[model samples]
Target: MILINRLRTVLAVTAVIVAPSGGTVLAAPSVPAPVSAAAQPTAPITLRYEANRRSMLAAGIDRPDGDFLLFDPNGRGRVAQVFGDLSTARRIAVLVPGMTNRLANFWRGVGGKSYRSPAVQAADLQRAGAGSGGFAVIAWLGYDTPQGFDEAGRANLARAGAAELERFVAGLVAVRPRATIALLGHSYGSVVIGHAAPRLPPQVTDIAVFGSAGMGVDDVAGLGTGARVWAGQSDQDWVRWVPAARLFGLGHGAKPAGPGFGARVFATADVHDHDHYLSPGTDSLAALARIAGDLP
Candidate 1:
């Protein structure tokens, strides 16, 4: 009986929400029963970067590796760190991680460098794109992320994180005005990016989501960003099993890589699992490098 109840809950949350009375939308039953994105307002929003900028900069932490400690709270684990030249870089890539990611686990040293880390992923992207032009990568750990299969696996975290992400992008653009920026969202980070998309800055040229659960919208058009949207998913990824629905805000809206998601499908060949999408020598890494570098 308990197992049956769980299955029923899953089915209920998986169904696309359709609120009658001119509010919610309904969808046809399919793998890609996408809900269209409602129009989002485009307005200039500001960021609060003053609190820690002076303190962090006076410490000279940014000079060594171009590390910009954008935000770090006293008692909290949320942080945003940038790698590479932010002052005059021609391009920048912002990496947003999924669940179980924090400043404490940002990097891991397996042998010499941690390929299993989001920080390393950013560093690898910086290396791949450096030849094309000046570039920087940001491992944005600016939200309170939920762990896998945790009770807090809902959209509230994403919705709040989305606002912070937009603010962070605004701060980045304020520093590097002409740089072409790309957002690389992995796993649940894609959900945050989707919520942030409509309000993203004009300098952002691309938004790429990989191993996403869903992007809180049906298709790329729903994102409401002028930036080109890209999606990639490995066949073996377990996130593919997560039902795509917005009912009760229990899950993200639609699968970005599913049929009719309307994102530019990129190849994820040679990427074995979910954690190593940015691992070196993989097609997924190469494609992300190209996007970050703004290469043809």
Candidate 2:
């Protein structure tokens, strides 16, 4: 009876995440074509930042202190805000967030916690790596993220996000050229990175994921990227309870941090939960900063 009850609970959770609303499956949003490497924008980074800021202000996004390289106020919005001087930086990090992230909660976190906000997290990473000099971080929200569990459980949104991420990285490489890049993703954003891994440019040296659902691969070799893979998950994170296997197109594959996944598992001992991995003063943040700065 206990086993049956547990099975039922698992099924219920899966239903909540994968079942169609109103008994009809909605079509996934169309993914835009990737911007080719040669076609990526070649404008000066500062000029692009200023232009984007002006556009954001015109659209009433109200980020007076923000340094945005890209901003589009359409739908849930798309933005890439830099935390340091990109033009002079030798090390660059791009952070991709997870579900329920929209322009509405871009600056302030979804639940109002500074640590959970993409902008704040990027700033924290920037500060942590400040000693390395010439390190910059970009809080990149260039894709339409899944808004709820139903969408998060599926891979469609992640695949779409991967395309956008690929295009953005191409543009970044076109502009920076010499900077070594690191990619960091939290939760479903890890899925996006996983899908983008095979196509990413050689400049990306590391790929780190925390609070991940899954990377849609059984192991690191399956990722098909030369970049070193890192994974972290706090003991208290609720994501540990999520099923680690992909089911009938509903779930992402094995947890990247789990044994045999072949990722360098980092310590998140000071992190409290899913949202706190990037929090200031945590071991997770320090490790992530090291990865971003290309420090061993």
Tens-place lDDT per residue, model 2, 63-118, is 84777777777789877889988889999999999998877788898978767789
Which ten contiguous residues of candidate 2 have the minimum total lDDT?
31-40
Where does candidate 2 stray beyond 4 Å?
A: 1-41
How much does candidate 2 score in TM-score? 0.85
Clashes of each: 0, 0
Residue pairs clashing in model 2 are none
Which candidate number maximizes TM-score? 2
Q: Tell me the TM-score of model 1.
A: 0.75
Error of 2 at 180 (Å): 0.6
Model 1: per-residue lDDT, tens digit, 111-230?
334775777788888888776558878888888777655523588888988998888787667657788899999988998999999999889999999999898888898999999999
Q: By summed lDDT, which 10 consecutive residues of candidate 1 come out lowest?
A: 37-46
